[model samples]
Target: MSIRLDLARDSGLTLSDALSVLLPTPAQDLSDLPRTTELVQPFKPFHDHFAAQGFSSVDASDAPCGDVILFVPRAKAQARALVHHACQRASGKIVVDGVKTDGIDSLLKEVRKRVPVEGPISKAHGKIFWFAADADAFSDWALSDMTLAGGYRTVPGVFSSDGIDPASELLIAAMPDRPGARIADLGAGWGYLSSRLLEREGVHSIDLVEADHVALDCARHNISDPRARFHWADALNWAAPEPLDTVVMNPPFHTSRAADPALGRGFIAAAARSLAPSGQLWMVANRHLPYEAALEAHFTRFEELGGDARFKIFNATRPRRRAGAS
Candidate 1:
């Protein structure tokens, strides 16, 4: 990894400065750090880095802090909670790092407001900020009150945290009927689509697949259908244990800093793979995305179900045989 020393020096530093400087060292030195622990949230890129470090892992919510490292949530509010949580449980320093787009600056401000600490913060293409605090005094912000939407309280920084997404609204409006069978909502955000789908007749069970664990937690709480199941799995990489009768999604178009139309296209292909031979797929995306070709490539019949200038809903039915099956 390229060192953004210029930016790092500007942000402020504590134990995080030494660790960031030593990030490229041999794995043995990293693992050898006595009482070192690493934590990361649902973001794929962040998780990949933490995993590459080969640090012992734990679910962000349940991970405990001793005299160890702590990965805070990417969101500003959750990041604050993580700092407090670490301080509450551990006697040593806590290391918090995240990208700028995730709001590291705001997180630093929030942390300062809650507990005064002089730490290292760096800003460049993005930013990283880390501080040290007592785990015993660390707060559990998730347990605290937060603003709500559609009856769900968000910790901040999760996608579509403010309100229902207009694209999803269009997609949900175009959902087709599938009675008394298995259904899956890919990229399920706060259980909106699945919740609406369950209201239809003949819907037996719905699996809500969301990549962000916090989003999944809010979704599980938002929609209380006994048949609804939530899984924190990547949409492109995960396969269903059993084929789904219907797959509905508003798959993410961007992987990180830039828009990746391929990611959305990949979801189209993955949706096809996750379905039974005749299972139907319904999706909505921005009008600019060139997804029709991908949809047609994967499913036998692909057509625009609905849309406006900004978004379009597409319905594609899986083919009984492969392309050109004879």
Candidate 2:
């Protein structure tokens, strides 16, 4: 929570055509983080926020920037990758800022080992540090595909990048072993369910729709099958190519630091809209969230299939069909 305005006041670094990585929306009544011509954020919902805020975004690897301001993410691999890439590509000082909760101190220490570290203004439960771009150092951190548990191809910072999410596993276990239906895995991360769906006896086809391009890229690698279609679009906005026979997912529950039930609710509505009359949905959510209202509104039938202490799976059938239908 280091006040970005302080970074401008304290740091001697010049900012022009700057690049912002995993940058958040500037707080209201605030001024003075470097102006970024390009933003590198993989999360789809945040992309909407950045665009609305008038920040031009470009891909992290290819963006040509004079300076960089990195809002360090929680994942060590992702943070390190951004730091290394920015350090290599930017022409000016690279400023790193993040809360201690987000591993700012560790990043500062590791960064000090790699380059000349400078004024780290500590404020608002976070640290803001800077260093001159050393294109030669941190060669080890260049982006490379890494393997996670269960042989899943994951880039750093993708949801559950370190391992298979237990909630997803529960959904997988409860999934129909013989889903003869054409399916859609909304918010499919790394194609875990899509790959598993292919393992079933009668799964006709699976459309893996995920918003994060990095995660979708890993999905492509994980489930490289002609039967598996891919869509890199927001789950809430993407409609199935055709009405689906079945939908299975663990809809994402949050976009930022705050819990967003609206995100999951939007997924439910999308599922209902894209399902055929006889189609069914198998979804998992946290036990306490209030998705029942949405499910009831969109589907003619809804039932809780099973649950554990942390997660619950549901089965909803016979989509209610929006106003005009065949």
Candidate 3:
């Protein structure tokens, strides 16, 4: 295996960003290789980018013995476990790749503490590090002993896994009482809100739209309603096939490499577009976000239902239409 680091001149931007432009095609080939079983986590876009190339992917599952795993660790603990798993089962060399902005360099240093690396270290926006390992050494680093907390067990790289997100909690509290409505949860990370909505007696159909394949995988397992549908979409570009009665979202606020407040702004615009003329939009967001102005601009009636110092929930409804007109 080979390792390379792509260093970025801009301290604010990750080398991964540079590499994205420099090596899009070749990187595609590398990520597309067929594997028996692959584990991708902690990052959604990378996993989906790889999955698009046709690899059998698993999100945050234990690496099957003899299976070739594509691992992306969101935390130190998960990185260690995947390294351990790879060493034990890998018939080929161990391959570990990460973006410098994501702290792949630090992770590599940690991995080196356990097993020595034995290949060319390559650098770009970050680095790709690989080494050989024996099954015993790998198994020693494995962590099956870790337990769940608050009924949610997360290995690593999941969105806000330590506990329930306050924003989601707020959104759930403010969810419409109307039953049998078609609902879509945009950026439904782990399906926390979506799953709760599914349990609602009033929900008729639910679509969980997550851009990251890894998050969607977790969502599928987390939400099992037959009415649940999953869409891997760039939420910025996704359009609903049909107008929806209710659109519930805790839209993501950031896009990689920049603080694109407009990311969520676009989601808001799309939600407004997707809703029926009389449908409602319930969304939760950080308190400081300048969304009230946007909400007012899009909807005929809007209200701030609940909030505290850190977060706020907005309820916006489209204008009721008058009798038959052009």
Candidate 4:
């Protein structure tokens, strides 16, 4: 790949650099790496994948010393923070890589304003750039902890980082007066729903399942009650330890830039699989998403609770088994 060649030649990343890789995004064919390379990824799903591929992957940036190589995320604020952190932490060069769609060019320009940058080579719909990462430049780009209307803890790169998502708010507002004592908040970003559910009188436990480790980290800060259990996991793949009485979610519907409703459908299927026979799923989505057929495939009953022009919430029950399927 272009990133590999760029690192080997342009960035001067050597085998003995005590390398720490950051936020390595999901990919099918990762190149071979030196045995000492530490793959530092915050997202649970991608971390598991990279680990399974025999790479040394970790969930946090805990390395005592290493040269940092960060894949610039789509979030501009986060990318800046990554570069700044590497500059302060890495003993060797800090290499940055990203695609055009992710604003790599703009990132290069912004980094150049504060420090000397090198070799912004364009390739494979993206760019690769590197710098010496010294002298405390670009420190102010680090983002501070932020809050929404309800004082939920959030960071700039987390999903719906700026505030509580309107879809989740609508789902919460339209919720049944009483959700079951045992509830699961699938795709629970930053624990907004789980924290609110804990406020209900009879909620025995609220399981917050999210895929993004960064968002889950914020959730840990936002939720404090013993009743809230957190799992940094892919909602589509995580199974409930026991059958849950209720499932609640504002399921994510996209991974790439384009809208992919299939993601929401996977959450529906996972919810169906994790629930008791009589369990119900309380969920919300944008008004135009086509989750009705998937809901019909999984649940025998569907009721539209409430909505505005932008969002819709539903309560579905009686998990159904498809014909000729186990």
Number of the predicted model whose lDDT against the real structure is largest: 4
Q: Each candidate: RMSD to true structure?
A: 5.2, 3.1, 7.3, 2.1
Give the Cα lDDT of each candidate: 0.65, 0.79, 0.62, 0.81
Supply the TM-score for candidate 3. Answer: 0.70
Candidate 4 has which clashing residue pairs, if any? none
| Model 1 accuracy (lDDT, Cα) | 0.65
- Model 1 is weakest, by summed lDDT over 10 consecutive residues, at 19-28
Q: What is the lDDT of residue 266 in candidate 2?
A: 88
* Model 2 local distance difference test score: 0.79
Ranking by TM-score: 4, 2, 1, 3
Candidate 2 per-residue C-alpha lDDT over 274-309 given as tens digits, one digit per residue, 9 for 90 to 100:
888889999999998999998888888899987799
Give the alpha carbon lDDT tens digit for every residue of 1-326 in model 1: 22433343345532332222111222113444322445434644345455677653333534344433433334566566655555555544555545567676676676666655544555444444445555444445644644565566554656777777889888877675553288888888777888888889888889888877777877887888898988887777777879888888888887456788998887887788878887888889989989988877788898997799999988888643345421
**Candidate 3 lDDT for residue 284:** 91
Across 1-326, the per-residue lDDT of candidate 4 in tens digits comes to: 34544455745545344888888867524565665678888878788888887888888775555577778789888888778777777877787878889888899898888778777777788777777867378778766888777778899888999877888888888876678989999988888888878877778988899988889989999999998889989988897988899999998787778999999999988988888988999999999999999998889899888889998888999987433211
Question: Which has the higher lDDT value, candidate number 2 or candidate number 3?
Answer: 2
> Where does model 4 exceed 4 Å of error?
2-17, 321-326
Candidate 3 per-residue lDDT, tens place, 1-326, comes to 11242221122212111011111222334442334334343344555565676644434444334323233444666567667766655555565666667667787777677777644245656565556546766566675432234354343545665567888987898775663378878888778887778777778888788876656766777767798998877665577777788888888786454566776777777778777787888889888778876776677789999877888988888733222110
What TM-score does candidate 2 reach? 0.88
Model 2 residue runs over 4 Å out of place are 9-11, 18-36, 52-54, 321-326
Residue 296 lDDT, candidate 4, scale 0-100: 86
